[model samples]
Target chain A: MELTNYVVLATILFTIGATTVLLRRNAIIVFMGVELMLNATNLALVTFARIHGDLTGQVLAFFVMVVAAAEVVVGLAIIVSIFRTRRSASVDDVNLMKS
Target chain B: MTDSFVAPTIDWIYLVPILVVLGTGVVGVLVEAFVPARARRTVQVTLALLATAASFATIVLLWRDPAVQGDPATGGTYGVRVLGGSMVIDPFGLAVQGVVVLLAFLAILVIADRTSTGQDAFAPTAAAVPGSPYEDLARRKGIEQTEVYPLVLFAVGGMMIFPATGNLLVMFVALEVLSLPLYVLSAMARRRRLLSQEASFKYFLLGAFASALFVFGVALVYGYAGTVDLAAVFQVLAGGGTPFADMPGLVLTGVLLILAGLLFKVGAAPFHAWTPDVYQGAPTPITGFMAACTKAAAFGALLRVLYVISLGMAQSDPAAQEDLFVALWVVALLTMVIGTAVGAVQTDVKRLLAYSSIAHAGFILVGIIGFSQASLRATVFYLLVYGLATVGSFAVVTLVRETAPAPERALVDATAGVVAPGGESASAPSAPTGGDPVGDDPSPAVPDAGVVLGEATHLAQWAGLGRRSPWLAGAFSLFLLSMAGIPLTAGFIAKFSAFGAAIAGPDTQGGGSTWVLAVVGVLASAVAVFFYVRIIVLMYFTAPAEDAEGVGVTVVRSRGPAAISIAVCAALVLVLGVFPSPVLELAAEAVKFVP
Candidate 1:
């Protein structure tokens, strides 16, 4: 029943998500990693809200969910556009601009 | 034990300026849906300009309102807290909002301008595949993407709210609202469609990652302070008597994560990987808008956060405060070194400016690190001057185009004559039917057909620009020199004040000396001068490439709006440099933030 356990779990999830984003070659998978990171934050927020005996963190979790959904909409639109033109979802294929 | 339901009394006047912009954006969407296609561009432009002007006017009215100004006798801050302390309409945030609105207005003029050939910088149909027959058909039909006006208004609305909010949750929302429109706009370039899409993808991925980090940081800070309000978080950290006082590590990690998100938006080094790509790939006008307005909004949020952390730790946790300052100092030094060092080697004009913007971010950070009222004033002034020059320079960039070869020139003229009957079509045949596509041409099925012209971005292409169009070249050189912090330019004053504030340090204890940053910044300015001046030399000194080869830069004649924007920006850059006292006094009066 230690709330710290939940915080630890959230941290693990966040690290995994960040790692997936860095390592994934597919654009869609990388986007999913970003979503996973957001979800992990929501989990942390809800747990924190429970621990602190306040609704602010819980309310913030809902806002995060809404924002995550909006981000998914825009992110998928962009990825899909790139996919349509190039016929590839791989991140490496998108490299037309190099210094 | 059910609590009685009650509404929080809201201050309607405090919220009007933001509402006007967002409201105009909503109406713009309706305009796109219902208005006749032929009139949509005119309607949208007029609406957007009026809304921006109205918002700025309201801000001025609010500035004159006696109720908004706090009494210095009581030691109260110079602003009102509205929406139950979620939004703080203070002098500092108001000043930033005013600057954003004014810059957005000028940028809108650039965005609304069409070249003499009657082409804007946006794709005819943003969702259409680049080089596809459908896109070609849409272009031939003169289908302008008037929706850009709405998107800009929404972004401006978010920017207006970004610096004025005291609640962390609101700040996060404002960040998203401002950023999402820009992500889409980056991909909607009329030329170089594939590059634009790739740039949008890169910006989105990185931007989303930064946002996720920001939210996680917010969660941790909430856990530590048990509130999502910035002022409350400060109270908890400063008191040191709270139950969570032992969790300084948690607070520090959270703060760093949040700062990372914001710094990414400001395009500081290490997080500036997206800036050059996005700036070069996006439509030139959109690039100017993003460069100027986005930096202003992000820096505003950064100022609020830095102010809170420094002042909060002043009372307790001095060691943690020192650690924070050390981190900022390292970031500032790295940002300056990388921006100037790499900027010097860039071959493309847009990428060079992108790096210059990164360096400017570092200089502004120097001011922020000072953490004093004088520093606050200097930082705001720097943002304004920087925005003016950036937008103006990019406007000039939009005017400089790549001329077509002799054989393709005839084809472009033929197409232009068939497309629209106008005398202006004779000399304006620089469209991309013949030029080898910069990157892999994704859809080569449809020829570019003289509809839109790509900018001449390569440094060598600008060789004879001075001889061809002396006034335009002179204006560009002025912007570059201003950026170089040469004497008698607004950039010189901005750099002087920012470095001066950094050397002065905070008029308080606990904030460390930033004189070293000021010294490094001056040296970086010296390094940055090499590239900017190099461009000037290339433009004025270097002879025109052999015209017999038929590949040279062409300065497109602006219809009207872009010219006005450039002239205003250049004039202000000079006036502010020579007589900066008026704006400097305004900035001094507007340095106080509400908690």
Candidate 2:
């Protein structure tokens, strides 16, 4: 399997994730989109590490995973906090401020 | 051959300032766990202040020592590269770190003040649902949120590192460290809990996307250069020590992607949709902190990219340089126009200030894009001045409140046949508190120990504030004038230096495009003055309408930490404005970036 092909697949996954974030109304779903985007980057990093025969990118991937986990914790805390108040996890409903 | 690995050289002294802040933050967390709830706020406040001050002192020590300057071995023109080349402590980074610590200290003063309401800006317990019995009960108990103090220390620590890290990976980590606490902090407002949460959510979701984009850009850049260390990447991009094709496409794409993340952080346009909402919704003090320190950190990192990294690109490929310049120019132009044009019409003071911050971001970008030594010095000076003014102004914002009358007051006024200027009734109920489903309830029956007043965010509520509280009004006006770049103010020096850099930069770039930036900057600041002056006008010129006294707005008079912070900031702004030469010389000396 060519390492380059993995990069292509990762790119596709990243697009889907970004699109999901843009399209989804549910805050949880949008959060999942963010997770997917991060994972896609992880995939790309790993593939680049393999292609280059260097462990730096692979180490970076681990860091990304840890960061993503942290993001999940904070993101869920915020989403849950808001959800408890509004009784919904929809982004559109969170509109008390405007221009 | 048997593998033998040796430990990398460690420079403990170079790491001291960062470790001090982070260590204090950890200690604060432990303090949270061990200390009695009643004693927590005091201890946390002391710990945070000492840590930030200690870090600042350490930075001064590091700055004075010639042995620790860059690399003694090769006469490197940067600070000590420590943590196995993950961080640097050069003069530039140190200056920025100093600014961060100073501003953090001031911000902490504002954050810690409790005299006005015997409650800080943060919620007593962030986990409690707004308006829920749990929240009301916590409020009744006067449960102090000492946890925010630790979070602030951690955020400040992250900020200290964000602009100083030598590697992209560490930069990303520092970015999150700085950002996460802020997201949590924004949600912890004592009043308008729902708006606070919404702001946090929006900041989190959008900020996550920006982070993802940043890491993706990092991956691509790593792929292009085969390394993440900035110096090594610069070497590769500069065309002497690389193993990849010299195709500009890969590198340019990576640069743009990374810039997207950075630009988002600085609240530059196209990426600025979140700025107004987040700034308006966050607690005022935190908003001020975010407006000031975050931009300085982001711009510091940006300067490294442009001066150290992109300088290599420009030398190797003129076309790539032009592309980068043009991209930044468009973003800067849009930010200036959008910030001023939209700011002109905002009725909410916080939102209006938010727009003004975006405009200031544009002005800073003009300096950044100019890519000269003058620009660097101007940017650092501008950041310091801007941070002081911002933190001070927001302190004043927290003081002004619109009176929330009991529901019966509206009925009494209705029966009395009274009308006032900007007519309804002089006793017209405060602007419909939106989404506050319990609006008719007047004020919460939460039995807290201090005065409960609604945030007077409406511009009309500020009428005759100058008459009611002259000193507060005067201080706020000074900050506004400084922000508007008026003469005899700190903002004037910052804007003049920034525009001076922009004008000087066109000669090196071989195009007249940068001159356009200078003009836009000047015009934008001019437009900005109208809105800023409008606030002063509303405060001073408009008399309080009949029966509106104490009903429309009241300035909370408290000789608390917030007042002290405001006084110090105002003094600093005036001092710096009048005697800028000493600071300018220092900035000039600290202008060098380590490649």
Candidate 3:
């Protein structure tokens, strides 16, 4: 019943998503990790909106969904292009540029 | 049942400049879809230039409109909050938009240039695989990717509205609107497909991560303040009326997380891992555009966030503001130190400039923390000057070509006059074909067929460029000098005003500790001068080395649009440096943000 419990759950999901992003080698998986992080944020926002009883956070959540979908389009296009070229889905292989 | 649904009154005039640009971008997309391939390039270039120019003209008209003129001190009559408080049309945001538009115009000119072997820097077909038959076919057929023009217009439209957005939701969307096109554009470079793709991949991934973080920050702030509007958030913080006021921890975390995302966009240290690779890999013209316009837009948003959000809090609870100042102070220090130290050791010119841009970001942050009207004005002026120099310098970079040696040239000529191994072409006025091996040859026999040129990115390749293309070298040196904050250049004036403001600003901003940032900035500029001058020395003093493996460089014949853009940027830099008062007065008058 408490809103803080929802916040705590959202925080756990966000942490898992971030960890997945940091540890993943596959570009697609990494991208999915980012998507997961975004969804977690969305969860947090919707919960907060309910707590506040205001529509602004809900409106913001809609914006986030639209933005996340747009991001998926761009992120997939890039990862697919790289995969086609290098014949690998691994992020570690992308080492052409360094300091 | 429905008595009446009330609609929010919209201010059409307040939204016109941004609308004009976005409308032009939509028109550009239609052009891409419907226009014939042969006519698209000319039509798109003209539309883009006209759109930006018209937007600038509209901004000027708005400036002169008596209805919109308001005094900064009173925050009256000078700004119009429109779209039910989602956007603010104020002098400060307008000034930033002007800078973005002007720089976008010049960058578009460079993008449209075709004199270097009668081809632009972009790939003939971006979807074609490098070294594939399809790529060769596209090149042979002379296919041009005119989609870049529409993409640029869209990016510019987003940039025009980014700083002006009064709501966090609109700001986040605007950030993506600007950045997505850039990710695609960076991958479309004709010469270095692999590196370009790599850059695009890295930028997309990191950019998305940062955005997710941004949205998370937005959510937390919403939870803390119960509002998504910047002005509302400020009021909530100032009045201590937020439900989360008891939990100040939420507010602090939200602000810090938000700053993290913004700092990433600005290419400040600790989040600038993408800058060098992206700068090095993108088409040179796009790099220039990204460097100039992106910095201007990001700094504009940053200024709005710092000044508007913090000012209210400072007025009500001054102690709450120190946390932000301290965080920014540390960031400024790290950025300058890391940027200059890493920059000094770079072998590629583009990467060096990227580092310099990061250092410049640090300098702007100093201006932000100074927290005065003078600092605000100085920061805006700095953006303008830096944009001019950066765009002009990249235009020059596009002109210089890297050439392979005789043996490689023979192989290249053998390969049906296409690019050699590594997708490089030895662009010279004369080069021998697959004739007998020209061993130990200083100059090979003349090959009638011309070669497509790539940019001379390597520092070694630039040895004695002053002899090859004196004017270009000279222009490039001037830009480098300006970036170094040398006297009699726009960069010097930029730094002078920024640091002067820091010293004279109120003690409340940083209680005089801000002076230390200015000192670090000067010292970093001094160290930065070493690398910049080293390049000048290499260009003017050193001879082309005789190592067979060393890549020789060619200075491509001048293209009209790029030349014109360079000339305009150079003239603006000099004029601003020597006689900066008019612009300074204008910026000073327009430096106030409406909160």
Residue pairs whose backbone atoms clash in candidate 3: B69-B77, B70-B77, B70-B78, B431-B447
DockQ, per model, reads 0.57, 0.51, 0.51
Q: Given candidate 1, what's the lDDT at residue B413?
A: 35
Per-residue error for B344 in candidate 1, Å, reads 0.2
Per-model TM values vs. the true structure: 0.93, 0.92, 0.93
Tens-digit lDDT track of model 1 for B421-528: 231123223323333222211111113322234677777778878988999999999999999999999999999999999998987853456888999999999999
Which lDDT tens digits does candidate 3 get at residues B151-224? 99889988988888888888889999999999999999887677888889999888888887878888888888
CAPRI level of candidate 2? medium
Model 1 residue runs over 4 Å out of place are B1-3, B72-77, B406-452, B510-512, B547-549
Q: Residue B157 lDDT in model 1?
A: 98
Superposition error at B52 for model 2 (Å): 1.2
| Interface Cα RMSD, each model | 8.3, 7.0, 6.5
Native-to-model Cα distance after best TM-score fit, residue B345 in candidate 2, in Å:
0.7
Whose TM-score is greatest here?
Answer: 1
Candidate 3 chain B weakest lDDT stretch, 10 residues = B435-444
Alpha carbon deviation, residue B85, candidate 3 (Å): 2.3
Docking outcome class, model 1: medium
User: Per-residue lDDT for B341-456 in model 2, tens only?
Assistant: 99999988888988998999999999877777888899999999999999999888988764434534444223211211122112123323222321111334223312245456
Q: What share of the true interface contacts does candidate 3 keep?
A: 0.57
Error of 1 at B554 (Å): 1.0
